[model samples]
Target: MARLAPSFGHLVFILSLLQVSVVCQTPDNVNSLLTNLFANYNNKIRPVNDQSLPIVLDVSMFLFSVNAVDEVNEKLVTTGFLGLTWTDDLLQWDPTLQNEIFIIFLPQKDIWKPDLVLKNGFKKLTEMGGDFYFLSISNFGDVYWYPYEVFETRCSIDITYFPYDKQTCNVTFIVWSYSADEVIITKSSGGIDFYEYEENSVWTIVSTDSDIKKDSYESEITFTITLQRKPRYYVMNMILPVVCLGLLSLLVFIVPADAGEKMSYSVTVFLAFAVFLTIISAELPVNSESTSILSFYLVLQLMIGALVLIISSIQLRLHYRKSSRGMSKFFVAIVRIDQFLRCVKRYRLCCKKDVTTVENFDKNEEEQSTELEAAIEWSDVTNAIDFLCFWFLLLVNVGLTMFLFLYITGS
Candidate 1:
């Protein structure tokens, strides 16, 4: 019995030693595990055992914020990180062999990463991610790479509505070197992750869409962000002021032709319209693909200002004409039309009958009527022109202002 007891103790001691040896075989530290894993790894090659099978890459965007939407440059600048995941067959390892470590982060430079590039970059086509970035790798060979970037992409600006415009911009990424047969990109289930997104002051994200476009040669993933401009700033600063100027321009006719300020006032308003147009042009891209309705409205107002200036000059010339010269039939007809319109507007039946009764008068009254009609002077002609122009232009300015506002806002 004593001999059997000694053998049993030795057997227990032997089992314990074996257990210690097994534990020693496992990696003691993360560095040692990485060294072993990468000793035979070749990052220059794709991490696939079967060269014929394509790498199914899942892609998603984690939008941070919209930095700017430059209308003049037709560019969209944004801050975001791309979430890319794929299986690297050569990177797999047994978790039990690495102190039960299921996941570890490695410098992105040391991995066989896909050569993803910005397909629609505003500057130039460049590679995604930086050397300082790290990639998360699991024991099952799954790799997760989050590459934060300040992406400036080409976005076609449609300023047809200007401040009230809604723009749809796309940020496209693709594997640059690999063909569609070798690298197939897919939009992840959680396509665009806006959980960490920050709001932009000038633009509000209305909607987002993501999809993978595969062609015969390569595959690309596109993230579409629809933005609506916050027009309060433009409405208060630009649009409203222009509208007021348009209404103010109509007042050129109201200024007395004898008032020395008539020409100067009309000229100043015309110049102001010119300055506003120049300011607006500087803000928009130099393209004729689509023009803003606001621009069109401004041009029309400028033309009206010019017409007012020309008519005012003519009125001044007539006001100073020799009083000995007889008035033309055209001027007489215009004066009569003006009186008739005013009488109709005031609902005065007596004033209406007085205009018609001149035609049916007796011989003595007819002669007096002729003398009265002959009393029309050049000053009367100028006043008649002013009255007609004022009402006509006021209606035009109001109608144009209402149409411009309604069209742009309702768009």
Candidate 2:
């Protein structure tokens, strides 16, 4: 029994030490501190003791992730938390009094905070922060509040150079109830904190800026985030395919007139361009203020396709004409130009030692000259049209493609 008494005393001593440690670490005076702090507190009133001096609130943001950028609707959705700090004279306490409580957290509803709201919200305005959120109050009257939210704000989309474009979006915030004279909002030392930011797949953050604009009526802070599109997806799927199709349309002149496929092939390609244009239009906003250069380029290609179909029909008509009908002067001139471009040379007979050989050569040369001097046939005219049209359309396609892409990239 005597040995057991000392062991029991040792166990009680250890338990007492643990109790003291916990009491020191946990701030047992929190309940009393809160009760005293809010006993005479009025949350409806600003936490300033002086009625003449305004409360200076510092504002900042910590970005978490970029959810989505809706171009058609011109909206930017982001997940982040707003950092707000201000001096709350009503909530201050002396840490040395009543067990040295330095910091206390109170329900955000129980304390006085700036009535901040998103001024440029895409949807209707609503109060920020949930009922469960809390505000941290320090011994010296500094209050810190972090309200996390998924903010959807209005952002004007300029898709003039879409898929290779950069956009600047602003999320504006203001104190709805308080005027600039009552609550002066200032940007924090760190305008925006990107330490917790996650990269987005479609858009890359190029830069960020914050501006605090003050007027006689109110003060507002705008956070601007510039994003550049990662264009590899559009380039591979939309751009490359459209360019290849445009070049393929020029192949109509390559098909022989008698092949019976020229008309159908040209018509099919023209329809394909129409389908692609429709698809692209559906993706973009139907706004007339600004137009995408890619859309213009597509329209030009479609026109070229239409022209190819018409020329194909004419070529087919000329090709089937009866040989009895002589070719027009215009047709003969086109054939001659085509022949000159192809470096076709006239046949000339050379002198031979044998009289019989000379005579035979002269007859052959005279016959060849007569055939050359004869009127051009309908077949020859159609062939010349095909050759000229192929090269002409090919140059046009190449020029348009190169100019469109180069201008887009440079811009």
Candidate 3:
């Protein structure tokens, strides 16, 4: 029993020492080890033993979402997470002492990170991380880094097609201070994520592609974003109303010339066409090189409306002319044209009746003369002109509408 007592005491002492050793290596001790790890090393510069050995940085980007794209300012705003990983022998440590496979440190506080800039950006993302900086070191001398960024990039736009246009905008990242030989940049996998994108209200994402471009001294990652504009709103609001206004111009021929409102009605339709032109012009880019087909059609319709207004004015003057001014040479020529077209068949019938009256009513001439005057008055030239113009204007309207429709659809 006495020998067993000393052995038990020795066992208890060894167990107590083991417990103390385990408890002593707490988080504070880990921090102490980290302090020692950075003691002799300068984290401000690249952790390379030889200054001539170039730092090869493997960069990759993954898109999370697109926030907004401002057309007026020509900026593309996006949110994504990207990583920059490189090998640094100086940051490596033995993992056996701490029983940890890797250690994490804030790049801002503990290490030198690559300075990457957006070459075509309107507003650059700040380095002050929204979350923790991704600076991790493995026991095998590998350093992994990453940062979440929101970039507002500048892009040149092609507004020739306006609401129907497809645009290709680029997001490029370049090393700020390093030459190609000093720091090499390479892509990770298939650069960006395409399947996880959310829907956009005004634009649809058509396609996305990424490629690395290198010049003599510069290297960059250029991501091309292809977007198509949604055109339902423009077609419904702008195009349909203009077509309705064009159809309204045809009403001038329906209203009789003697109604006293024919000229005024045609002028009103002409003015309405002009107003729509102004409205559409205000919404689109004025400096665009390609003329909008809608604009061209509106101008053609305006010209047709103006011609109708002028023709109505002429018809009204002919209908209301004083008898003292009696058939001028111009009026005679128009009557001959109506005769050639067989539009004045009533005039021919009246002439035959007058000849019959002159022969048969030689005996009772006074009564025959009165009947002849009434027939002559009913067969006036203005009535023939009204009949001819109505059919002519109706044909013109139908032909133009058909032509314009086919042209627009085919184009």
Candidate 4:
């Protein structure tokens, strides 16, 4: 009886297989199968949220040169989720021929007002960031393909940045390209479709888009970025300030090492460097992980500042070396008194005094150091300015050199 039962089950299975094959081979049967499959598939997928669909929007390359964005509603979405369209503009009135576009999507689920403070909410979309993917020209999926120098992202505790929250999350995606005149966004598809279990609404995505286009034929590279916010912060906070500080070093050459305030400028430069660092830090996200070119600049500037202080110390020591026992105390004491009016008065008859006494005093000091004032080479604090300035200038050039070097080599 047991063996018979097994044989019966096998016969039933074979019959089912035969029935399916026959149905599949027939036109009517095949239609029925397709209808059932589509019905079942759509049933499973239709109720899903936007996140469930990994595809973004399609980008249509239409114009040769453009820098603008047009917000499209859900109605604007094409019926079929398919390939993006590429359009070419033959009118060479402008230089490039591709439209610049940055398409962003906010999940529908992020539709709640955030207290934003202690206002616990779902982590920001980026916090949930996993893999980043894009379609390519060939195998083309590249973030670097864009022409812009910086990617703009805003971080705020405000709920308004989220589209669903009625507050739009600001996403600034910038591009800079000379070869492309205009670009159209036809399709943005492909990514993990995220679904919100609670709201069952659309997932939230915060995005910002922007563009800067420049045309220069003489330069080998027609496209160049003016803002340093991405790397621009480096210029405002580190590179520019460093360059400024370097230039300030010229004060060393212009201002005599004999100037009483020479040492003071070291402190001034140090504070300036410190202030610049603060600005750089302020511009970056306050987090544990160090990022951006500004960080490098911070380190560089701080090093430069430290270097300035060190050189200042060396100046003090150098001045100390040039001074003999009694003379050192006498000069120091004399400097402390009335701007050294006593010393200048005693020596002024040697040269024709003019309204620009300070300027002439420096000339005389240099001449005297070389000729008459052989005993007094230079003061420590006074000479510190030149040394500090010299080193600072060198560091600035090095920084610029490095910036240009890295920019060129992409190091």
Per-model TM-score on C-alpha atoms: 0.84, 0.84, 0.69, 0.32
From the highest lDDT down, the ranking of the candidates is 1, 2, 3, 4
Task: For candidate 1, give the lDDT.
Answer: 0.83
Clashing pairs in model 1, backbone N/Cα/C closer than 3 A: none
lDDT winner between candidates 2 and 3: 2
Compared with the true structure, what per-residue lDDT tens digits does model 3 show for residues 192-261?
6643667777778778878987765977888888888777887788766776776777677667766778
| Local accuracy of candidate 1 as per-residue lDDT tens digits, 95-126 | 78677677889889988999999998976766
Q: Count the backbone clashes (under 3 Å) in each candidate.
A: 0, 0, 0, 66
Write the residue-wise lDDT of candidate 2 on 131-225 in tens digits: 99998889999999999999999888887887688889999999999899999999865356775789999998888889999998898899999
- Better-scoring candidate (lDDT), 3 or 4: 3
Question: Per-residue error at 236 for model 4, in Å?
Answer: 5.1
Candidate 3 TM-score over all chains jointly: 0.69
Index of the highest-lDDT prediction:
1
The per-residue C-alpha lDDT of model 3 at residue 139 equals: 65
Worst 10 residues of 1 by lDDT: 350-359
**Per-candidate RMSD, Å:** 9.7, 8.1, 11.7, 22.7
TM-score, cand. 1: 0.84
